[model samples]
Target: LIGARLSGGGGMVSVAAGVERVGVLLEGFEGVEIAAVNGPRSVVVAGEQQALDGLVGVCEGEGVRVRRIPVDYASHTVQVEEIEEELRSALAGITPRAGRVPFYSTVTGAPVDTATLDAGYWYRNLRHTVRFEEATRALAAAGHRVFVEVSSHPVLVPGVEETVEACGVGSSVVTGTLRRHEDGPGRFVEALARLHVRGVGVDWAALLGRGSGWPVDLPTYAFQRRRFWLESGRGAGDPSVLGLAGVDHPLLGARADIPATSGVLFTSRWSLWSQPWLADHSAAGVTLVPGTAFVDLVVRAGDEVGCGLLSELVIEAPLVIPEQGGVQVRVSLSETDDSGQRTVQVHSRAEDAGPGADWSRHVSGRLAPEAAHADFELTQWPPAGAVLVEEAAERAYQDMAETGYGYGPAFRGLSRAWTRGDEVFAELALPEEAGKPDGFGVHPALIDACFHAGVFRSSDAERQLVMPFAWNDVRLFAIGATALRVHLTYQGTDTVALRLADATGAPVASVGSVVARPVGTEQLRSSSDVSGGRMFRVVWDRLSVRSVEVGSGFVRVGSV
Candidate 1:
């Protein structure tokens, strides 16, 4: 059939949209016929190869997406008549039988008795138009809402969804059995999961029934959204020069030696004007501080005391920085204990807050002696055994933005990424326009970019919005680096060990472990207004003119 069609120059082309308009355009062409209506707008036309090519050109000229079907033969057109005798002779032995189950025939655009599917019927189907859209509509009209295409790939799911939607039939779910190139056990399991999420009951034994394979356990802790901009505070000048004692940290301005108590308080104030890069981090349409900034504060506070390790910092809330006004942060440290560990807590409130305003405690942790570290290196540049994640790694930032993690130029430092067994590595740089890295012990944006690399883990699981909830054994070894190379190895559950280095592979910082938890939009909305503001206006669309006769006793009002 392909040889014959190739000799005769017959082919097909598909248009993605403008169904009605494209149908009108096709009417003026020669030898072309509407081969299939897969969906409301997924239309396929087939005829002489020259006419099909012309149609594709016209569609492209009008800005409609068109794809040429890879085939030398055109079906469902007058060209089939040339092969009619050959098909009849070849299918002469076909014996159609009645089936016990119902069958919706695209040939008839409705359910048909299978007893009528004889060789002649098959021949007619081959030579006639394919009414896929109409057949799908028939299924929807018959109260069928859930559609699972039992095919090797999901070429028809989108068309099924669009067809069912145009029927105005409440709602429907369209899924597929497998996808091309993703025919593995995990993809099949994901297909099952899609059904499960839509209230469908699936057999659990299907996956576990074969082997001793088990699912990887994920973290279940609830956490807040991430949108923090942490600035590594730089010592401005001598604090003792003024009457009061102060800390030279960029984020901290004054230090108060509490009288009669063994505690000390370090204070700093931040505003958009002062730390403009903070505007880059936003979640649920509100600007908030990056969670890494808390780690930065703890690291600085550890330097202030003799402690060099941030033992563990757990976030309790997200610090939302309002568009106007500044927020003041207080990092309070307790006296060293028997273990030489001092409790540290971070709290914040607006600068103009009233006397009775309650301070929001964002994070709390303990500073302790540095822990022994594992020796690691990223000097191999692209890494020895890692492979580019391809499209997933390239689309990292775009995917994050879609899930409410909007990043501006400051935090968009991830250049390239690669993955190896149980580990992900990223190339990061703090954009120069973000600001000078002069004062920071470890610039917050650059460090935060390390966490962004974690998104690549979803290549094996579901894509989710995750935030760093706990920092353990964090220590900064260098300062004022504009670029970094980071390595994150999966520890357990949702935790990873972070190793940071400079462009030349020199060590800058390390985290014994960083634990992450998923963030929900509901939790974000609780603290900020993320409600949708909707407005409506009437639109006039072309309406068909029609008339109906009035019954003897019934009165008809409106004019057509």
Candidate 2:
């Protein structure tokens, strides 16, 4: 009845033939009016509720099943139909005028001609189907930035969102009735102002003063360039020039230029070495020879300040050989003192005159200072052909879990092992208090924590976080006293295959596929929330580690 009052009741039609005949009978009455010319759709009769119920009963007694809707009255009867002729005569006496802005027709889903706003257009509007969706899409495509639903309830906003996504339209549509504050209209204005600021960086006042138009052109801004120094030659005392290379400079003005000197400092070579080997294989035997060379450089510069500039340089020359049956090589280094004294040092080793000897070999000493280095010597390589699986996994796990919050109890007793050319696997037992009522439960958050620990221990140190982009084939079977095992196989940078199992190695949950990416500390920090208060309080009088085992394993348990 409310909808009929607003639309003039011309769009209602009874689908049932019996109801249509009843509508015809009601139209014959004097009080009612046929306000619309609705076509072969469900007819809406608007009148007093009691009278409508009585009419329904009368129709039902005549073998017509009449269904009464939650409406007030009967509409679109003959009484109202008679007014059409009178309205036509009244409109024919007046001259129509044109409008500036174009108005669209919801009935036809297209623009309507203002000059042809005649009686037929109004009559057709009552019979034709309402193509609201198409009309809304047209408005959106025509660059309408905002849409307001002025109805009593919000029913069109959802349809608009779906339509916009489907049609690939970029305009923002909003429903005003859903605002939370009592002063919703004010809030809407503020939201529009904020949107303008975000889109064009113009304040609301400035936008309003400029008639809400955006600027077309703006001046370009530039930053100051930084300067650096590059050596023209291979010595510290050699002349250097200032330029923008080899150093990262800030966007600030350059510093004051320093005074230059006319005299140039040069370095002298100190040592050099060269070795050559020759061999011949015949019926008699083989012959071989070897030699060596070295060099060093020294630099000297007069002290304009206090101390004279001096530099000692050394070079390890590589070996050179002929393309014949024998080979030759060279090695050398030169050093210069403060007084420009140069020295050279070289050494060579070769074997070329024996049954198992070859002339194309050269040996040299270590080029770097000797320091203690840790190396893992594996008995055999992994069966999967993955090198350093255990070490790499350890590093990855440590890096992933270095959040300083300490790992969860689910990560207790974690261990990893790799079989050469076969597979790399790791297992960890959950602490007893992990999933208890007073302890952390097997919720999504706790699962994420455990995942971080596993990933951190098995990824690169630079990888701060591994985003679990997806989950597949995941299942949770039992809880309490059961450990969780995570098995992972990396395919590439963005894809990984994962399998999750319980303490007994039974497949609890398996994800045949997942995507992951190595994230940096900035991303991790921004993604995580920091809480201030204590997460959990342990009422313990004292706490200490009883003992620590170095080689066998490390275990620490405490009590409150």
Candidate 3:
């Protein structure tokens, strides 16, 4: 088609935003129109070159990411009308019928009648907006979980993943057939392996020319999970030389004993360079260490004191990371009380603070040598009679973005979720690109994702910037979990009892009760030097005469 026909002098660009926003951006440019709504956060517009260039500048100035699609012809726009008649004439002799396996139409975003697939229909398909997002969503809603893009390259896998995530489908796997330059045998085998690892049912008999194999359980710990928390410090000297114990942790540097009260103090430092993953846990345009990290600190401190049980931990304030420089973390332990419990307090301060700067307390908790009996199990999958929170699942990510809790790749672990009487359940996993280390009893991002499904648990009236306020009788049964099945049972107002397990229903962690409360944004700013920026200000410039007058022939004949 390119060699024999006209390549319309137009262009296309994809914007990382909603279709509504893209529509508003093109309101003044009639030559431009939305070609496709690929996903909730992805839209493609095609139109004249001049209009696309202007749109790119406007999007970039507003901090909205947009990219041109590197094409000359405007697709799925009014420009397609120019070749509509020719396309119809060329395809007039062709006939489309129902496939042996049913066919779904992206033009309609659903299954269509085969009789309607005539030359006119083909022409309309070329000129109308593509409904890729809607079609993928319909397939997901119909209980189809496994998707294979049998194309020359993996053009739509990312879009499929985004659409599936938006639908909150329970456990969907998408794989590609081939690649651009690597469409060899090795690539094909790797593609099969990808599907195999994700537990997709495959007809191996067809390929092997032998009997099929039955599925079997993977051995315990057959899968490897990356260690994500408590890494070694950078550019720090050995604390042993200064009568302090060297603490090996990603966020902590050393520890010292408080001889005055027979207590212990744990010290650490943080910077964007030292812990770049912290940048992923952003909320309300501020990068703060997740609340789960604070809980992990409590657990680590518990192990050191022979009190391995976290009785309770409450977040007093958020630990915001400044755009520049670093912050110091201090976790101090009080002397053991009669019940063998020690008071725990966590505080942080900017490294380059003035002499008068004070360590702001972020969390307070207690550690006990023993914990009372508490068990949370998910023996029966999905809990009988649980209904899928379709609305909540579909809007989870979009709603989160609107509320300022933007989840980057690291924190985007939630896949699908459901709810039953007073209970919410979800499926989560560590993304391949999350780059989290192993060795943690429970990775913060994995645990923090447990609360994602709770978006449906609250009414709009109760929604706000909230953090984990209190945790009671928390326990960890397993360590270094990468995939988790979470269950949260609401106790009362803003409280729940959390239960976690591996993919195979093996217990990982449990909490007797959890309490959450909203915090003030001002308090968060006070805790860190990070501040928000004013992207734009009201500029009411004085209305002046136009530099170029509208009309020609400016001779003042009437006045003269």
Candidate 4:
């Protein structure tokens, strides 16, 4: 596998050309052939090292945006023909039997007879081009609704989904078992969770052994939704200073320069009403800031300096929005170190707190100078073979809401979107009616909308409510963007690295990596104590329990 990534099986070339165009290009290549017909413009070429290299050069020289797919062995071409007889000999003794489930053949693009599963059939299966699209079409035509790829890594999920879409299978869902480079057991459980959320019944007892303990009945805790915002003591600075320049971010009040200090401080305030969207996100019924909002603050801070990338950020506390008032927000960026890195921290206190009150640190991170961006030369507008995501803007929030992300008007900013293979291109904007505070580097509403655009690339299983777990190498270019054009490329199973640009396509911000994960109510609850020492506990012994068996001469008893 390492060889496949770095060298070995050589590279696979993806050319955005029609079949005839690709056939003309491969006329002189001896070891190359069309591996698959993915979409109208998606043509893949597999071959030995020299032939693959020549094909890539030819495609690029002709102004085609060719992508090199990593793989070690050249399968489905003449090179694999050399192992055919050996494979047949090695499998000659195997006898095939019919199974409970119908086995569809990717080689034949249809269901195969058990008698045809002979040595020669296996040999040809290995030597032939994988007819994944045809097989998918066959399944769709046969009314299959769910397609699950049982592989450690979901290498064919995108293809399968694309084929299903092309085959006009509207109700179909495509999912996988695990992801590459992830914890096997954890990923397996996650896969099962995905299935469960999609309404797939799983035999939990069989999978986890029947001896497992039964569920314990317990009393549930009721969370207090008391207000926590301070009404006064915002800062030491003159209140009139806010009249100068300002930003539209709730976490940031106004930009102020530290007179003696080398860096700048941004002051802001947050309440449930600061942005109506805050109320839409609650963990265990308590309204706290989502981690993705913090990413907005960090990236905005990174943009203040030349550093656009948030190299690292650790969220320590749940910044709960109080019921009556709100919290005062301050984002501080220290002087740049010798390595051109700066310390960034987010601190907040109740608005009613005294001037001498200590501010609690919520998030801290390091901001580094902009690194090289993985630019896709998107200058070509949607690329040659990209597919436009129809009605993406209309369905973006609806689909996300179905998975527990109930975005409000402020958070529903996806304007339009498109998808090209694994990459998603989208345009997001902060609505003027959102009425955000002014002077934000990049308002959370707008940035959050940028993340929301990811819905365009989501499968049903991926539609769950996910939040940014960690951010790395985030860089900002242009600051205070109300509208943005975003390019999101998949980095892993649950991670996407993004590049941000203004409406005119000017670079705004780029992220090296941002990992996201599905979040549940339990995981989102605030651990901080703001209930004023009021706590509740239930004593199970206080409750009554009675059980009795009844027979011809026995007594029966039951209690509620």
lDDT of 2 by residue, 263-319 (tens): 222212211111110111000111111110111011101111112211222222223
Q: Give candidate 3's error at residue 556 in angstroms.
A: 56
Candidate 3 residue-wise lDDT, 1-560, digit = tens: 42245375788898878888888888788689889988877889998999889988777666465767877888888888877778888899988776666567889999888877999888778788988899999899889999999888987887888899889977888989887766477677777888988888666656544322323567877687896554423345678877889764555567898986758999888877677777888777778999888887678777777887898898877888876667778999999998888999999886655556677888998999984343656655555556556545347767777776868767778877778878998878887645564645677878888998888777777778788889898888887889888899998868888899887677888988888887676766666663223233222243444333324422222221
lDDT by residue for model 1 (1-560), tens: 53754345688888876468667879778999888889987988899988888887776555455777778778889888887888887787888888988799999999999988877888889899899998999989999888888888888897998888789988678888887765567667877887888888777767454233333445688765784554333345666765447765567777876677767888888877688999998876777788888888778877777788888899887877766556778889998788888899998876656567778788999998665354775665556666656654348877788777888878888877778878998878888547888667887888888877777776535666667898888878878889898998998669899898998688888998988888887776565532112232222244454443444332333442
lDDT of 1: 0.77
| For model 2, the run of ten residues with the poorest summed lDDT | 291-300
> What TM-score does each of the candidates earn?
0.51, 0.26, 0.55, 0.47
Q: Which of the two, 1 or 4, has more lDDT?
A: 1
Better of 2 and 4 by TM-score: 4
Q: Rank the candidates by TM-score, best first.
A: 3, 1, 4, 2
- Candidate 4 per-residue C-alpha lDDT over 1-560 given as tens digits, one digit per residue, 9 for 90 to 100: 22323246545677766667889999898878887765545678888889878887777566454667757666666666666766778899989887777878978888887767989888777567777667778888999878788998986776777778777868666788887766888778877877777777777756664432433435487655775653333354654566534644555556776777668788777776555567655544666777768887777666656676678887766687766556778898998788888888899887656557778898888988865464533344444555557678668867766666656666677877777777888878887555653655666667777777677677886566566767777665666778778888887668888888886577877877777776676655644333322133211233345544334232323443
Ranking by lDDT: 3, 1, 4, 2
Score residue 235 of candidate 3 by CA lDDT.
47
List candidate 3 segments past 4 Å from native. Answer: 1-234, 260-262, 354-356, 371-374, 391-394, 530-560
Candidate number achieving the greatest TM-score relative to the actual structure: 3
Q: How many clashing pairs per prediction, in order?
A: 8, 74, 10, 27
lDDT of 2 at 361: 17
What CA RMSD would you report for each candidate? 22.9, 30.5, 20.4, 15.9
Which consecutive 10 residues in model 4 have the weakest lDDT in total? 531-540
lDDT per prediction?
Answer: 0.77, 0.36, 0.78, 0.70
